[model samples]
Target: MIKVDNLSFSFPQKELFNNISFTLEEAQHCAFIGTSGSGKSTLIDILMDPERYLFDGKLEMDPDCTIGYVSQFSELDNTKETTVFEYIGEPFIKLQNEIQSICTEMETSTDIEPLLEKYQFALDALDAIGGDDFESNIHKQLNVANLMKRRDSKVADLSGGEFKLIQVMKEMLNRPDILIMDEPDVFLDFENLNALKKLIHSYKGILLVVTHNRYLLNHCFNKIIHLENREIQEFDGRYIEYNFSLLQTKMELQELAVAEQEEMERNDTIINNLRVIATYNSDASRGRALKARVRFQERLEARRIKAPFVEIKQPNISFGVDNEMEDAIVVSVHHYSVGFDELLLDNVNFEIKSTDKVAIIGANGTGKTTLLRDIFKNNHASIEINADVKVAYLSQLQGEMLKDANTILEEFIDAGFKTYDEIGLYLFNYGFEGETLSQKIESLSGGEKNLLQLAKVSASKANVLLLDEPTSHLDTYTQLALEKAIEKFKGAILMVSHDFYSVVNGMDYVLIIDDKTIRKMTLPKFRQMIYDSHFDKDYLETEQKKKSVEMKIELALKNTDFELAKGLVEELEELIKWL
Candidate 1:
């Protein structure tokens, strides 16, 4: 059990949490959902500290309660010569040392009674924390994470995704009172994410996760906590329900404010008319009417509500395609075998058309990135490209674009991918405000940088896109923006992504890359093989409605018809009743 009261935190320039409070009972599964840079991760870190109450808040847990945290940014220490097995049992090893030292000192010490009591307490604590079965638990978790074969593997030799899985499994083996995971699904392929999702559902303790993975949040979490605009909100259900509530509340609140303002304005006009009449001739009736009107205006002023930040929010984004782009096969690969030391995948054959939406999916280390690299190198004879066709690639980090000399707005202008008006359009879609124009490009968050990269490529004359994990660090809202952009674009798309939801909605064809093998199939069969039922009727219909409204809004904004855009956005909000 845990309780937080009036918790507040501040960064150097940004004030993150302001008097936030919440409680988590034992066995309650909750998720902290927020956009990028919303301080959700920072809050989890603060929760791990025993002295967290020193920072203007009170964090209380039942005495002797232990907390286990697996940080998203934690990396294994490669300098240390430790194996996965040894790392998983570190907590148990420390407990063993404490008990050993106590017993050894008790054998020859004069204070035998107190030493004996200390020894007994140590043993009790060990049993309480499941120290006796630590090794067995470690092996069990390894099997679940599909790392049993690598139990003896060195931490330094593991890939990033493998290291992440191991760190999480290690914590699960520790069996603390409360478990916290911050974006544990980040950088994980679909296979590993499925395992993690199952593990979270089976966790018996208090579970608190900070993640933007829509599938994980919706399927594994029973409660939702949202952070925005320096305030915290609690919802009884999952992300979809919370999102609907948020949108509906904003719409209703805006409606009230608009009506109240109109009433106030009309009342002012009446008061001014009475005042003019009173100034001409001070009749008793005129004076009385003016006084009543003034009092009424004061009452309206006292009760008026101002508009909120939600009204200023916009979903404007674009990925430009060549206006003259024609529908034809852009590239064709046949019997492709790519490898250096050993072949990763072979017999990979697929055709990408000018309007095709394809997804490249596979487990970790299964040659997804290698295939992309081979295409980039253009040294393989098994691949063929259409003549006079242009292509562009968006890598994992898009680091090169983020580090450019231009500002966020300047990058698009310099690349000539979009007009000045459309250059700033994506900033708003990615949730960046006008203030971002003056900031350096490197100062943007991962999601913002991803959007900027897409903007740059959209402006090019390329009709084919080869993207590697384009949704890597993006939050759910931005991912939705991406999904809409993908649907509207006329060019062909071939992307390798770890996000299964994005792949399911964004792609029509699926390519499987496995251990030295390649197979092409349709998206529906791939989803069915994975036992996916996430795309139910209600969800799809609501999503289609949202997409249609968004597309209309984007077109109106592009035409610079703000009035039509405003009205359509209001209609979009009204549709939240079905969300």
Candidate 2:
């Protein structure tokens, strides 16, 4: 129901999109993906309100279409005393209040005709939203989100992640023609994430979600709109298939580029020989041959392979250590209990050995962030840290750790960088450039802020890192890079995260908090727990075979063996059928 044509947008320092176009139709779920700070969120804002910006584009949307949006950093007003049920039914409540006001006015006003018309319109709007049964619908949604117990709880009292999900529920129940969610899965626990997945899958209207969560990307989207290098690539398939196609194309391009290079080298040698002969003998034909070869070289250069996808840039993230601990427990917590109004964690014990990578996992409101904060502070009597260990922390609430009023350069300067050149040089590795360094941290996107946090962590030279939801606002490429960095780090790590792929791939083991206590679980058991709780019975096996076929197909195509590639395609098709 929406279309963008020849759209181009840029800031003063950088061009975000150039002549990019895509269409969103009814019942289509589109995943908007790109590199960190690639303007995915900016483009969504433009789509929501084209009149708000001066840009070159044609945004054609159905006039009757109503849009529901959930932004990445949205939060509830803490002073407002609204219950979860009332919050989700605000639209319904508003319409009902209008109708009641009109009825009351009709009894006292001389102009009853206008009041009658207004009352009729309000009734129609309320009926359209099913205001009659909105209470029941709200209950059902709360139950689906596993928040039935908190239906009467104040929304402001809910945790950040829970509040985000409630916002989503509010928008969904409004039943707009289009729904756009930016990083809705961020900070969500596993159960809440599962609820979001189900909601996206069951949404009947057009959906445009910006997320880097691998689970959501794999399970929710039917189309992928990838923005990279000021260009857009639209894939009309699942993300898995889209990713495999990109890999296959990269392989083919690389193979063809190599062949072209060899041909160009041969032409260069022939041209040189012809020139040498002409210089020695003054032969006219020799000169003509050299001229013809030069023209051929120009043509080859014009048609050379350009693989933008293959050259997609990811941030160079590396965590440094000043002094690596040797075979000792870097952090130890014994009989640790932390909570505010109620007991969340009671006498939980966990330890991180030197060079060990551990993940602390639990449900929402189970004191995961609280425990991490306690460790970072190292102030509790039950917590112990090695005297020689240094620490760095990446908070899930990036804004809390970052000064909002400070510019990027100023933030770094305050963080202990001595000179402008040093700060610029260091920030460049995290994708911050010269002009962007002058921008305030509050003006930056969520992903950009997270990258800034990572840069700070890397520069700390700490032997132990406490990372909480590090992959939340990062792009897929950055997330992969972080996994690599985590794998290569030379110190002990304790992370609190809900990202399944990051936890499974990067962490050595898991410390699961359950029933107010801590329990250690091996990676194998953790993997099985995820599969049993969320995935299909044969998903793991099917994914392995699919990956194998995809690689085989890439190789076959690169070698110009069409028959082998076709056979591999058939095998992949069969695997997809089972999926």
- Name the top TM-score candidate: 2
lDDT string for model 1 (55-149, tens) is: 66787778878888887667657797788888777778888999999988988899799888888887887787688888888888888777899
Candidate 2 lDDT over residue span 1-579, tens digit each: 899998999899889999999999878999999987889989999989988888898899988889999998797799989998888888998998998889888889998888888988889899877789999988888877888998989988898878988899889888888999999999888888998887787677889999999999988999999998888888999987787678657656766787899999999999888888887787787778789999999999999987666668889999989997789999999999877888899988888899999999998879999899989999999999999999899998887789999999999999999999999899888888879999999988888899899899999999999999899899999998899899999998899999999998889999999898899999989988989888889897797788789878877876777668767877787787676
Question: Cα lDDT of all candidates, in order?
Answer: 0.75, 0.88
Candidate 2 residue pairs in backbone clash: none
Could you estimate the TM-score for every candidate? 0.76, 0.94
Cα lDDT over the full model 1: 0.75
TM-score of 2: 0.94
Q: After superposition, how far is residue 568 of candidate 2 from its true place, in Å?
A: 5.7
Runs in model 1 deviating more than 4 A are 49-65, 76-82, 97-125, 146-159, 240-315, 377-381, 385-387, 398-401, 404-429, 434-445, 458-462, 532-579
